[model samples]
Target: MFRRKTTEEVPAQTEPRPERPGSKGRPTPTRKEAEAAARERAKLAQDPKAMRKKQREMRVESSRQVRQALKSGDEKYLPARDQGPVRRFIRDFVDSRLGFTELLAPMLLLIIILGTGVLGENMRLFSSTLWIVTIILVILDIGWLRFRVRREVRARFPEESLKGVVWYAVMRAVNMRFLRLPKPQRKIGEALPERYR
Candidate 1:
């Protein structure tokens, strides 16, 4: 009765602990492997020429992708101006219609030839008249295109901004079909899809 009882102490664990969820599930890397990896990293860091060359190659590839995208009308690689469904719809709409502005380039060339007296002095008056007529037609065509594009854009994209859309459509309409960037997804008079994206 005079002797006090002692509490038993638990033994320290010797077995390996269970892996936690999301653990790597492998043994830690050895010192040699770690040293090798560090050395490789240092080697890459020290080689400025190789790094620069790699960067240049990447940029060239990126440029190539952008050019291809512009030609093919792929949305992922298109430039800022050509991106978005609204711009695409505008491009298709402009491309599908034959506008008088497309004739302006060839007419201007003819005017230049006539002005140079290569076609004879009598052609000069004709050239001036043609110039005036072409200008008037272009103005009328642009005005009509702006109105139609604005109306369609409003109907299709109710909440979208109309800021530069009319101008963008006009510019696209001004270019000859073959010369247009993102190259005319819709053919002349082809019905456009309900959605552009």
Candidate 2:
């Protein structure tokens, strides 16, 4: 009976939704759909009229690079020893020169996480526990796979530099989903052109 305060209604607190359009989007594509969109943009850049103008451009020379790279060795592109450090770094960074199947999905997950935060909201990419858990799983999976691959490399080439951890934290992203028509080639990170860089 001596209590001075009575029960008061309390207002529920809500999370503030981050503003958008007002803010520029992160530079890289965060999802497969985004990457597809980027591919279409690339096609348009290569040909403003798209297919109409695309018919005029010659691709015979472009495929030559792929052939030359393939013919060069068991590994695509020139050997790292022969290439400039910059080129070699780019090659190793992009193509998952470390391991293929194991790294594919993990790299994709990483790119999405980083891409989401490119604009402003530091928490934009991971506003919830779900995203955080997904990222953690990706890291664990990649770490586990890399450890296994490195073990094999060590066993096979014990005397040589058998350790090439291809894990990169950067937003380096690139994809060419040619089969998905009207999609631009999506490339992120250091590979980004100087203007975008």
Candidate 3:
């Protein structure tokens, strides 16, 4: 501590003061380079084939994320529904054709069954009814999974919208039920860069 000659006391200054740089300027990327980069991003977002490829990549990454979450004892993953073409059709089918999604359908089905029992000639119709129920449930299951994976991607990335419409369509195709099972195709681990894995 040091006593100021004119005032009171001033604390001892021991730390070295940091020096500020005198001249600093923003970096300037070449115009040609900037244009090239922009084009590359647009291609990634708009190219149908590239978009499909990214969707396949996303599927694999999603599976790995699930496996890792399970291994680490975290209950964080949940699914979200996108209003895209596939989801729209699936939701519509579930809503209109299958009574399994809305309570009204099940209730109506119950009513139909009771009415059929009373009517007495349409009991054979129950067989077809049961088959329809099974199909609806299967579709619902696939829709549910697709929604979940899409949700995980949204939560993990910064982009609210996907690259573009074409890419989105491609991704939707790649994430089809037939392609997305945990079979022995290329995996997230295999697809990722070595450093990321």
Q: After superposition, how far is residue 91 of candidate 1 from its true place, in Å?
A: 0.7
Question: What order do you get sorting by TM-score, best first?
Answer: 1, 2, 3
Question: Residue 192 in model 1: shift from native, Å?
Answer: 0.9
Model 2 weakest lDDT span, ten residues long? 176-185
Tell how far residue 56 is off in model 2, in angstroms: 20
Q: Tell how far residue 13 is off in model 1, in angstroms.
A: 46
- Candidate 2, residue 36: CA error in Å? 50
**TM-score of every candidate:** 0.77, 0.30, 0.23
Q: Score residue 139 of candidate 2 by CA lDDT.
A: 65
lDDT of 3 by residue, 78-179 (tens): 233333333332222222221222343444566566555665657547645765665677467546645643554454433545334323322333343233
Best by lDDT: 1
Looking at model 1, the pairs that clash are none
Task: Give the candidate order by descending lDDT.
Answer: 1, 3, 2
User: How well does candidate 1 match the true structure in TM-score terms?
Assistant: 0.77
Model 1 misplaced regions, further than 4 Å: 1-44
Q: How would you encode candidate 1's per-residue C-alpha lDDT over 89-183 as one tens digit per residue?
A: 99999988999988889989998888787778889888888889999999999999999999999988988999999889988887889899988
lDDT of 2 by residue, 110-186 (tens): 65676577655655544455455656765665565556545544554455453343332122222322221112223
Q: Comparing candidate 1 with candidate 2, which one achieves the higher lDDT?
A: 1
Q: Cα RMSD to native, each candidate?
A: 14.2, 26.7, 18.5
